[model samples]
Target chain A: MGEFPTVTDVARVAGVSRQTVSNVMNTPGIVKADTRARVEAAISALGYRPHASARRLRTRRSSTIGIRLDPMIDGISGSVLDRFLHALTEQADARGLRVLLFTATSPEDEISQFRRLNDGADVDGFVLTSTTADDPRTEWLLEQGIAFVTFGRPWRSDDFTAPRHPWVDVDGYSGLHAATRAQQDAGATRIAYIGWPSPSGTGDDRRRGWHDAMLERGDVSAEDLACLEVVTADGVDQGAAAMQQLARTAGGIDAVLCASDALALGAMIANPARVPVTGYDNTPIAAAIGLSSVDQPVDEVAAAALELLAGEFEGKSGAPSDPAPPPFRMVTPRLITRQFAAIPRDSVPVNALVSEVSR
Target chain B: MGEFPTVTDVARVAGVSRQTVSNVMNTPGIVKADTRARVEAAISALGYRPHASARRLRTRRSSTIGIRLDPMIDGISGSVLDRFLHALTEQADARGLRVLLFTATSPEDEISQFRRLNDGADVDGFVLTSTTADDPRTEWLLEQGIAFVTFGRPWRSDDFTAPRHPWVDVDGYSGLHAATRAQQDAGATRIAYIGWPSPSGTGDDRRRGWHDAMLERGDVSAEDLACLEVVTADGVDQGAAAMQQLARTAGGIDAVLCASDALALGAMIANPARVPVTGYDNTPIAAAIGLSSVDQPVDEVAAAALELLAGEFEGKSGAPSDPAPPPFRMVTPRLITRQFAAIPRDSVPVNALVSEVSR
Candidate 1:
C-alpha cells in the first residue's frame, strides 16, 4: 500500500489541532471558512486521505448506520423522506459512517431487518424515522439492548418523565403556534385548523400549539374552537372537502391552517371566498404556488440525530439518572410566509353571523 | 445458540430447490406466484429465517452493495434520484443484498471511499450510477478486478464491440421514438425537440432516437431539422428560452419534446406557439398538472441491475473471449399521455403569420 498522510500529518501541516483536521474533512460545510481554507491547503499540499477501514478496525466499530426504506409508497408529495435520507447520508459521510439502506414491507418486517443487520455486525447502530405511538420497533430494540436514536419522538405511553432512548424530533407545535399568531396579526378572527386524524403525536402537538397560541391571545371563545377544529386523512381531495364543509358552517371560516402543504394547496384551490390558507412542511408545491407553510429543519434533525446516536457508543448517556434527558433533541421548525391568502371584506364575521344570517 | 431453520429447511418443507427458496425471499415480486406461495407457506410452516451473518460466514460474502450519494442537488424537480434510491433499496432487499450509501465530492474522493470499503470487506459488490465517458471510477474498479454493475452504460469511446463491464440502462432512444410517434399520431408534423447539450451518453441516446424517428417519418427536411433540434442546459428557463427561439423560426413548430419534465413544464408555461410538449421522467408535477411524459421503469432497472451485479459473483458470464456480449440490460420507458395539451385550431398557424401580423 502507498503511504498516505494521516490526521497528525494534516494537523502539523495546517498548524491546527488533530480534531480540527478531522472536523474539517468529516463535516465539510460546517467548519470556519479560514480554518477550512488552511486545512484544505494542508490536505492538498500533503495529498492527505483518511483510511476509514483502518480506523474502523482500530475502533472495533463498523462505522455503518442501518436505515430501512418503506416498500410501499406514502402520500408525501415532495419526497421529504428522500430529502431526509439525502441529508442523513451527507451527515453520515461527514462523520465517516456508511449508511446501510434496506427495505421493509411493514414495521414487523423492519424489526426483522434490524435483527439481521445487527446479527451480521454490518452496522454500528441504526437510525429510526417516522416513529409513532407505542412503536413496536422501539420496544423491540430496547428489549434487545440495541443502540439507536430515532429521528422522531417516541410516544411513550407510560410516564413522560422517565428517561428513555435518545431521539430528535422537529417541533411542529412551535411552528403552528407561530402560524396562529401570524394569522391573528393578519386580521383573521375566525381561524380554522385542518389536522390529520387524532391520536397522532405529531398531529396532537400541532393542535396544542394552536390551542396554546389562541389561549394566549385571549380572544377566542370556547364555542368558536369547537366549531373550527376538524380532522381528516391526508390528501388534496380530503383537504378540499374539509374546507368546503367549514365554509358551509353558519359563521364561515376567515382563515385556515393545515398540517401539510398538500392540504394548504388544496384549500387555496377550493377557496372561491379567498380565505387565506397556511400549511406545514413547506413542500415544493407550496414554494411553487407561493403558499404560506412551515419548513422543518431536516439538516439540523440529521445532525442532532447522529450526535445523539454517537453518544451511545461514546457512553455519554448510559445511565438513566444521567440528568441530561437522554439528549431528547427537539429541533425548531420555522414559518415560511409566502403568498399570504387574505380574507375578503364581505366575509361574514363570526360574532355577527347568527344575526346577519337570520335576517 | 438456538438452532434456527435455514434455507434448506424451507426448501425441504416447500418441496423445491434451495435456490428457489432463496429466490422467493429475494426478488419476492419477480418470483412466480405459485412458487412464492409454496416458499411462503414453507417459511411459515418451518418458521424459517435466513440468518444473514451466518449465510455471509458460509459464503464469504457481505451481502451488501456500495453506492455513492452525490452531495450536490440536481434540477430534477421532484427528486427522481431519491425515488430511484427507494426502488433500488427495495429491489436490493428482495435480492437479499443491503445497499451501503456513501458520499464523495469528487472522483478521487470517491476512489478513496471505494478503497476503504473494499479493504474492510464491507460489501460483496458495488453499483455505479451516472457513468460518464472514460469514467475514472469504472477504470479503477476494473483494474482492481472488483465485481460491480453500473446502472448506466459506459460511454463507448473505444471499440464498441469489446467485452466491457456489466450495466443496465433505461432505453431513452425508444422512449423518445415513442414520444415522436405519439405526437405524430396526434396530427402534428413540425415537431421540435429540446434536449440537453450533449456528448452525454443519455442525451445522445435520446437525441438519436428523435433524429431517427424524424428520418423514418421522412417529413423533416435538413433545414427543418436544423431549426428543430435545439440544445441547451437543463432547466425550465432554458427550455422556455429554447422553445421561444424555436417559435421565432419560419415554419413555426407544432409539437415540442423535452429531455426532462422540468423543461416541458416550462415550455407549457411559455407557450407562445401553443405547441403540445412531451417530457421525459414523468415527475409528480407532470402527473398533477396533466403533462404527457415518459416514465422510466425504475423498478425494472433496479431489478436488472441487481441481477447483473449478482451474475458477476455467480459467474454467469466469464472471460473476454466468451461469445456472448454482456447483457448490457436495457429497460424500456413508456410514454404517459396525460391531459394532453392540444394547440388551438383558431390560433394563427405558422403559414398565417404574415397575414396576421399585417392585419
Candidate 2:
C-alpha cells in the first residue's frame, strides 16, 4: 500500500489550509459550502477514513460498545439472528453507539479476547449474547469491573451478594403459554410439546409454560402428552425421528409446540403433512412457510439491552428488585400464528392419515 | 459496576506482593501452581479481563482489524456474506487478529466511523464488504491513506490506481459456464437461466457464462436461450412468480439454473414437489436438500481479503491482480450437485422440452 495521505495532503488536495479541513470536520456548517464540498470531495477522492479508537482515546469517549458471540451459536438459522442483529443495530444507532463484533472459537478464548479489547480501550462497555447456565464470561466481567449487560438471564444466588450484572431476557414461559393457547383455540385438544434441554434458561421456561397451559385446559394429562428433547447436530433429522416417536404413543397428538423455528422446520419435514405444528421465535423461515409461532419482541429485547447498558454506563448500578430478590427486570414475548397451525376441524385426523410421522 | 480489583487486590487476596499478581498475569508458569491457582481464583472472583488495546497502542503493534458493513448490504441474503463472515472468524482466530465491527449508516457516516476507529488506534487495517457502484467510502479511504480491501469489483476507473486499496472477487463467469455444461451433461437440451440483477459483477459474469455455454451447446437459438433477471425479496414467492413467467414463455423449460439457494428455494416452493433446478452459492439449505450449486470458496475469499488488507497495512498499496482488464482477482466457484438436480433423462424427454423452449 502507498503512504496514506496525511492532513497536509488533504489540505493540498482541497486547496485549503489544514485548519479549514479541521473546521470542515468538527464544525462543518461554519465552513463555506463550496469549501466544505471541496474538502468532502477531496476526502472521498483520497479514501480518507479516520481512525476511531485513537481519536476516542484522545477524547476519552468512543461511544462504541463491544459485542461477543459464541461460535457454536453461529450455525443457527440466519433469520433468527437477523431479527436480533436488526434490533441491536436500530437501538445502537439511535443511542449513537457503534458495535464492535467479536467471536470466540471456544469458551476459553472468551477470556483472552475480552482481555485484548478491554486493554485497548477499543470500547466503552460490553454487550453479551447467548449465555449458558454456568457462564464464566459474566463472572469474568464482574471481576474485571467492566460495565456490561447480557442478553440472557444470569443464574446467581443471593443476587446482592454475588457480583451484580444487568441482563434482559424474553419471557419464554409466557411465550410458550401463548403458543399453546393459539393452538388450543384452533381446536387442538391433544397437544404435544417439543422443547430443548433444561440447561437453557429460556428453553426450561418454555417447557414449563407448555405444561402449565395444557394442565389449565384439562383436556390432556401428563401421560397423554409427549416431550421431545432436541439435540444439536442434525437437528432436522432428529426432529423428524422425535415426531414419529410422539405419533406412536397411545392417543395421537393434534398440535405440536416447538421451542425454536429450526426445530419447527424439522418437525414440519418430519410430521405427516396433515399434522399441524406451532413454533416459537417467528423467524423468517417460519413466516415463509406460514408456521404459527410465538414472536418474541426482538426489538424490545434490543431496546432493553441498550437501555440497561446505558444505565450501567451512566453509573446506575443494579436496580431494585421485588421482595424475593435484590436485582430484577424482565421482558415478555408475543405470539404470532400463521396458516400451518390453523388447521380446520374437518381436516383429516392424524390416525386416519399415514398413522405416523413421515421420515 | 464496582471498582475492579487491581493487581494489588489480587496480590492482597493471594497473600503475595502486587508484582506477584502482575507476574502471574504475564507468565503463569513462573509462579508456583498453588500460588497461581490462588491468583487465578482471585482473578476469577474479581472479573479481571486484561485490556489488550491499551498495551498495544503503547507497543504500536495491536493485533486488531476493523470491519465496516453497511446495514443494507449485510441484510441481503444469498450475497456470499454468511460464508465470508464465517471465513473471517476462522482466519482471524488463526492469525491472532480480533475484529472490531462498525456500521456506516450512510456514505457520510463512513468517514467519521473510519476516522474514529483508525485515529484511536482501534485496528491495524480493515476488510470492506459490499461496495456499490461509485462508492464514496472507497474514495475516502483512498484519500485518507488508510489500509483496506474490498470483496467486490470497484465502480470507479481509478480504483486500482489507488495503491493502498485492493479487492478480491468470485470468478462468476467460469462458475456459471460450469453449471450450464453440467446441466447439458445431465441430458437436458432445454435449459433456462434465472439470475439476479446484472449490476452485480457476479451476476453479470454468470449471465455472460450462461450465454456462452448455450451458444456452444446449440440448446436453443440466441434469442430463445436468454437469461431472465429476478428481483430479490423476503422469500421464494417472488422467485416462483418470476420462474412461472419464464416457464410460461419458454414452453416449460427442462433444466433451470438459479443465482442463489434462496432463489432456488423459491423455485422449489413454487412447484413444491417436482422441478429440476440448480443454484449458485451452496448454502446450508442446498447441502441439507442436496440441491446442485456452485460453491465459492468462502474460506479462500476471506483469507484473500485479510491478506489484501495486510498488504495495504504493510504499505504495499496494490494487491496482486491480473494485468488484463476487470482489475480484480477472481476466485473460481466449485459445482456441488445434490438430489434436486439429479433427474434422470428417462424421467423427462430432452427433445420434448427443447421443442417447448423453441416455441
B-chain TM-score for every candidate: 0.76, 0.73
Candidate 1 clashing pairs, residues 3+ apart or interchain: A26-A94, A276-A341, B26-B94, B27-B94
Model 1 is docked with a DockQ of 0.10
Error of 2 at B174 (Å): 2.1
True contacts kept of each: 0.20, 0.16
Give the per-residue lDDT of model 1 (tens digit) for B188-267.
88889999887788888998888888888988886678789788987666766777778787367778899988777667
Interface RMSD of each: 19.1, 15.3
Query: Any runs in candidate 2 off by more than 4 Å, and if so which?
Result: A1-62, A72-79, A156-163, A226-234, A316-328, A341-359, B1-62, B72-79, B155-164, B227-235, B288-290, B316-328, B341-359
TM-scores (chain A) of the candidates = 0.76, 0.74
In candidate 2 the C-alpha lDDT for residue B241 amounts to 63
lDDT of 2 by residue, A2-64 (tens): 123456777899999999987765555478878988987786566454454334433435577
Q: Whole-model lDDT for model 2 versus the true structure?
A: 0.63
lDDT of each: 0.72, 0.63
